[model samples]
Target: MKDEIVVITGANSGIGKAAAIKFAAEGYTVIMACRNLELSRETQKEIIAVSNNDQVKLMELDTASFASIRTFCSAFKSQYDKLDILIHNAAYMNHGEKYRLSPDNIELTFATNVFGPYLITTLLLDDLKKSKNPRILHACSNIIKHFFDPKRKIDFDQLQGQKKDSKRHSVYKNYCASKMALLMVTFKMADVYQNDGVKVNALQINGAKMSKATLRKVKPHWRIIARIQNLYFPSPSVMAQHYFDICTSDKFETITGKLIDHKQKMMQQPPSHNPNVITQIKQITGSKVYPAYAANPEIQEKLWELCNSLTNKNMVTPSSEQHA
Candidate 1:
């Protein structure tokens, strides 16, 4: 375990920071990939002091930007020969009512929450494969199951939150859509890399207490509600234990392509299992949803193609070949 390497995005604070400390204490070399280098450096110092593990390092990464994702992958590959785990922990939620675009000209929330991880994971496949036990974990939300609209399919055409749809969708709606999309990708990757020994899974840290930094990002009203809710919720450290368990536990060694709840229990498959629903989602957003993607190889290929085209990187072959 002392020689294993782990990379966690958005590790400057919140659960990401907590997870990094947990892994470091266990003797893994933890790399903290974050957008803000200064904050990450401070957090790195804190982790080193607490865990007494100086193997923690920081790397610049902004998941919202395609160029930044590519650049970070290149830098990481150059420095590290093997990656045992990759945690897609960075997420964005806008409090403003208006829609915003990332530097890549995609919806801000979707870019960070979905496409960013999509690109980064695909690009780093080779690095991850070098490890004897490779694992990829996506940080998702339980709200996806609650807020997902069964009636409304993913609008690939309006991924950027067009002005015409502003009346119909709110900021929260966009956030849910992004998370649902990510869940789809999570299932798809789990199947795609199953044979290659890379375990892929998503976990929702439901009802976890938010750090002060995270709370500041919440809307004023939501922050008040969150404060009230935090009284009964577990701390981020407690919630992070679930993450550490899934990554290192022998019980989960064969558990690939499943969404785990906050309690570290496997979530039941979504009610909708229609392949057409997955097809419709892929046709628009370039990804499938839930159980459908878990079984359909054709749909998975289409999603990989779309993601490749969007990022301008053919990191994965269309023929289901795993990169070593």
Candidate 2:
């Protein structure tokens, strides 16, 4: 019997590493795809020692770079015949950094948090399809609520870094926008790949304890706030267990296009109110409103096309490649 193969991006630390350990312990072939080989090498040792299963492998993958993504896919294809599970766990966020771009000149946050997962899933679709019950889990953030608020709309210019805002927490703003875009993409992908027997779902990450490295990058005042929040946040191990349960349980085998929270409950978008009419609703109910994009398909398609346009011939979509 062949062991199921699982690939987790950004598996060097935090939840990714913890998930790797959990999967390895289950006797699966866990591939730790990450940007930092040095950190990953250390993590590989820990995963092996802790799991007592030596099938953990390390490969370089910089989700922020399109070229790196392509290389990683090619390398993976040469060695592995199938991918049973893919966890898009790698994310890039900065507390107070100025605007940045990937090597492909896309907005860094979108490139990593949204575009990277889209490209990886597209590239690895065939490998995933080879498995009888393949699955793709996107590690999504609940911070998307901020971007999906009634006051906000999808900013096409900002998504590709063509426009910059003078907002104080522009980086955090980018992070939220990217997360919202990711959910849109995840639902779109669930529809696109439905016929191929690929199950795509987004995991809505609640507050999780922050790593020291992540904490160090925060501004001093915010670091204090983060510490206070950390006291209430679930540990990474608890979150990793959730990842394991979702992957291994048959209950999720057919569940697609859903946003699942840490408590294993489905998250539905709040009933959308017109931004203009939000005040009316509030006045009528005297309760706060959670207005969102409704996971609008038209907007999702436009964003999908924009992301596809940014890629070259090698990164064509599955449907397009089919016609070609």
Candidate 3:
């Protein structure tokens, strides 16, 4: 484990921080790639104090910004020749908020939750390829079931607010769509790099207690519900153990292109209830729909192309930076 290196996005708090601690305790070199350097430094100290492993370090990275991603990768390449594990754990969900754009002018949620991970992976692919057993883990949500519902279709034209339809601008819905996109990227990359000895997989994350910073951002109306979830759901530490397993456990060493839960069971899709209200609404509205985007090879290919174009369009040349 001492020789292994792992980079976890958003590792300052929540499941990311917990995962960082677990990896540090195991003597792995844990790099906490976080948007907030101040918070991350504090967390770095905490992890070192708790795990007694000074290998835990902090790196600034705002996944929503392409420039930051490029800079982070360049600095990482300068310091480490190889990356053993990469965890796409950072996510942005603005419940009850207006649509926002990222630094690259893409939909903010999709930029951070989808495009950022894809771009970072590409930028660091060579480092991952150098590892004997490189693994990339994507954090996903059950909300993707909305996209999988038979009646709902992922309108390619409407992605990233291209359609500009206010009716389709719901933040929560866009978040779900982004998660679905990420799952598609996971499967596609798994196929693309299977022969290259790089394993790519997604985790179907279950409910976990939200951190105070996250709780503060929750809408007032949803606060009570969020609190209730925190009370009954598993803690971040519990969920982090699952992440650790997928990265280090031999059981997952050979697994790729699959969605696995905390119990280590492979999932085809997130569980959905029998009475699908979303399906009923679409039927009543007579809305034109497409099949599930995750399983559709055509949609997956188009998505891959779209992401490539977006990242390239906003490309920034990476240059080495002195470590802080």
Candidate 4:
């Protein structure tokens, strides 16, 4: 693992920060892609100071923006010859009254949790492939379970969130939809890149009650149950240990497209593996991704067609960093 090079998104604070610090401590080159430059720099200093690791570096990447990803990837490709690990650790939970759009006019939650990782991963797939043991880990939440009601219909008509009707929906609904989309994509990606030795997986850190500061930021309203859970769950650092295991764990080196539990091998949530659920996810993603890139006839038929038409690029090739 020490021989590997790693990049993490949303490392300015919270879980991302913990992952960066732990990865760096293990001697992996940790690139903290943050939206804020000054904060990222300060974080880099702080991480280095504690870990005493000089291999850690900080790069600015506003995961909410496609342009930022392109620029960051371009510069990263120029500097490093290979990328071993990529953790889609950064995510935005929609808690507001309205749906937010990113610079590219995509829904804020959708753009950050779904498109950001997809665009970056597709763009950098070649670099990830260059590694001897490449792995991509996506940070997802159990909170997504709350949104898994089969009774409700999943919406795929508005892939870009161009419509404003969603403004009426609760922020929690929006957040759940985006996460489910991300997990579905991971299932698709794992199948696509498995043959290439790139193990793509998603995991839940459960609750980090010990992280008083960060926990408050994510869930401000604490009821009795929330408070009780906080007392029993692991701290950010302890939970990060599981994340660290996933990033560099040899146990899952051969396992791809799995929904890991606290960094361990486990079955996915019932809905995650349901054939019907898979069908719905494909419909939502326009079939751009299949269970595997090699298989899933619909993925080749629909998603490929739509993604190229939408992005107006070479669909799934390595993306260059595009900046203003």
Of candidate 3, the 10-residue stretch with the lowest lDDT total is: 283-292
Model 4 segments more than 4 A misplaced: 165-167, 210-229, 269-324
Q: Write the per-residue lDDT of candidate 2 for residues 1-324, one digit (tens) a residue.
A: 137999999999889988999899889999999998986798899899999988999999999988788888878887888999999999998777787888888888889998888888889999999998999988987676565445777667765556645454387777888888888888898999999999888887876888998788789978999999999998888888888878778989899988887778767665544434666555233312222463777888998897787764548323322222
Better of 1 and 4 by lDDT: 1
lDDT of each: 0.78, 0.81, 0.84, 0.71
- Which candidate model has the greater TM-score, 1 or 3? 3
> Model 3, range 241-294, lDDT digits (tens) per residue?
989999889999999998776676776532334437776565333222212457
lDDT of 4 by residue, 1-324 (tens): 466899999887877888888988888898888888885788889999988899888888887887787778887887788999999988887354475678887777777887778888887888999999888988877655544344543344555665667546566666776666676677778877777888998885566753454546544554445568877877678767777887677787787877776647554333235557566564333312222221334643354344335444523324434321
Q: Against the true structure, candidate 3 has what lDDT?
A: 0.84
**For residues 106-129, what per-residue lDDT tens digits would candidate 1 score against the true structure?**
778888998899999988999899
Error of 2 at 56 (Å): 0.7
| CA displacement after TM-score superposition, residue 102 of candidate 2 (Å) | 0.3
Candidate 3: segments with Cα more than 4 A from true spot: 160-168, 269-292, 313-316, 321-324
Per model, how many backbone clashes are there? 0, 0, 0, 10
lDDT score of model 4?
A: 0.71
Ranking by lDDT: 3, 2, 1, 4
- What TM-score against the true fold does each predicted structure earn? 0.85, 0.89, 0.89, 0.81
RMSD of 2: 5.0
